[model samples]
Target: MIHIYLCEDNNRQLTRWKSVVEKYLLMNSTESQLYCTANSPDELLEIRKKSTVTGLYFLDIDLQSEKNGIELAQEIRKYDPRGYIVFVTTHSEMAVLTFQYKVEAMDFIVKDEIETLPDRICACIKNAEVKYKTQLDSSSRLLSVKVDKTSLILDQDDIVAITTCEDYHKIMIHTKHGVRQMSGSLKELIAVLNPAFCQCSRSAIVNMKHVVKYSREEALLTMDNKETYSVSIRMLGKIQRALKQL
Candidate 1:
């Protein structure tokens, strides 16, 4: 189920959004709920931390607080990168600010058009449902590995690099969140990974999607997260070909 949150300072507007969202979800039989509502950025952020699943957020661009809507959305991304954000505001002209903030908002709903607010919010929810479902369909993107008696299921996109650890039988899986060590070999892990990963070196296999820049002369690769990894000369041609596919 998807969690829906709303942040609006105006009490009347807040109530209206809550009512419309709830009614729409009930009428359409959507597997979602109006989880929480807040009147300030801080309050909403506090509520956001408790969300266990990807959420749909409706934020007012001009919140009467220290941080406005766009700023709040920026903070939200730090915790929930894949969550959907929709800006519901009276400042229609401020739509361009979402781009400047690089928040990747799902939609911008102008509150001044009161008649259309319900429809717009419902549309955003529908889009979020589709995107979230697509993300959950991880048949080709999931990396499942076993460690001891436990099974670890990881999303391949969250993985940054998989390399052989100092231990002969242990491999380290570097992810956006942190690192994990499992008793295995890079060769075994690579066999299960998708083509988006490239064996850049004998010791390291980097996710090509996260690689930012590659220097053949230097034999180095920089990832989107600013981590650097060595690329073996033999794998340079393979890396180049894989990058082209990206």
Candidate 2:
């Protein structure tokens, strides 16, 4: 389920947006729920920590506090990297700041267009719900690996590749965020992973979902993130078949 959050400072605007969101929720039967509403970034962040699932956030750019919407979004990303963030603010000029902040806001909604505010908000919710459902469905399977003292539970879809490290006893997990070194064997890890993972070589197992292009001549597989991995000649046929299934 996609939890929804709203953060607006002004009482009137807050009430208006809350009303619109509540009405939309009542009228439509979706997996999205109006989770929380806050008058301050602190309040929102406080509650955001409790959410274990992805969220859809509608934030006012100027929150009249030290942490504005963009900054709050940066903080939110640390916890919910795959969540949707939509900025609803009167200051349309602040839209450019989202790019500088690297928040990847789904949309910048201007409150000046009062007539369209409700529609835009609902639209963002609708679009986010569709995307959230897709991710939730694909993420039913999880991979748990120990990174140092911490155990990280990851969505199988997020893993780009897993390769044996130089130490042989340790493996390197290549994800979109970064690489993580963990103690494990490729054969052992493959036993726990889904069918989407294919061992391209003795040292590396690549997620078929992340395989962008494969060159049989070069015996290389290019990932969606542009990282390349070599495939053993014996595994070329298996890799080709797996990619075709994707």
Candidate 3:
């Protein structure tokens, strides 16, 4: 069950969006509840209050608040990283900042297309639904890895490598999405990882699927992301065997 949240300061626009979203949900038989409609980000956040309900958010960039939609999404990530954030804004220029901050924004719908705005909104919501359901379908294939205080459900296929971070009890996870810092026993992490994953070095394990090139001379394993990790001398034989299977 997905909970949809909307934050738009303009009364007319907010009403229109609410109508459009409701229509989309009804037309597609999507199992989502319209959770919140707030004129202020504070109201929305206050209502959410530590609830980690998975869902989607349609936010207006110009919120006329201390924090705009993007900033609110950042704050929301602190509590609910699983939710999808789709920005509805008049400004097209701020799109770059979204990726730079690693918000992982699903889509952006410009408010300029007044007539087709509702249709565009529907498309974005549909896209979010497809992506969300795809993730849910692979939920059984995901490993729930804890990064600091945040718990991330990661698809093993997206994982590239896991390496000790030099900090005590910390591991750095390299994924197709990006690097994540987590705390765990290397033994614990390796034990939970898939068969394609194996330790290459005393401090690192590379996913065979992500290993693009393996250098025996340099004892280096290059991942699909181009990040290179050293192979321990003892694990060289195991690494070679794994590389041959790939």
Residue 62's lDDT in candidate 1: 91
Off by over 4 Å in 2: 140-246
lDDT at position 121, candidate 2: 95
User: Which residue runs of candidate 1 sit more than 4 Å off their true CA positions?
Assistant: 139-246
Clashing pairs in 3: none
TM-score of 1: 0.57
Q: How many clashes in each candidate?
A: 0, 0, 0
- Sorted by lDDT (best first), the order is 2, 1, 3
Q: Cα deviation in Å at residue 175, candidate 2?
A: 30
- Displacement of residue 104 (Cα, Å) in model 1 is 0.4
Q: Write the per-residue lDDT of candidate 2 for residues 51-143, one digit (tens) a residue.
A: 676899999989999999999999999999998999998889888899999999999999899999999999998898777656645756556
* Candidate 3: Cα lDDT at 15: 98
List the lowest-lDDT window of 10 residues for candidate 1: 133-142
lDDT of 2 at 243: 78
What TM-score, to 2 decimals, does candidate 2 have? 0.57
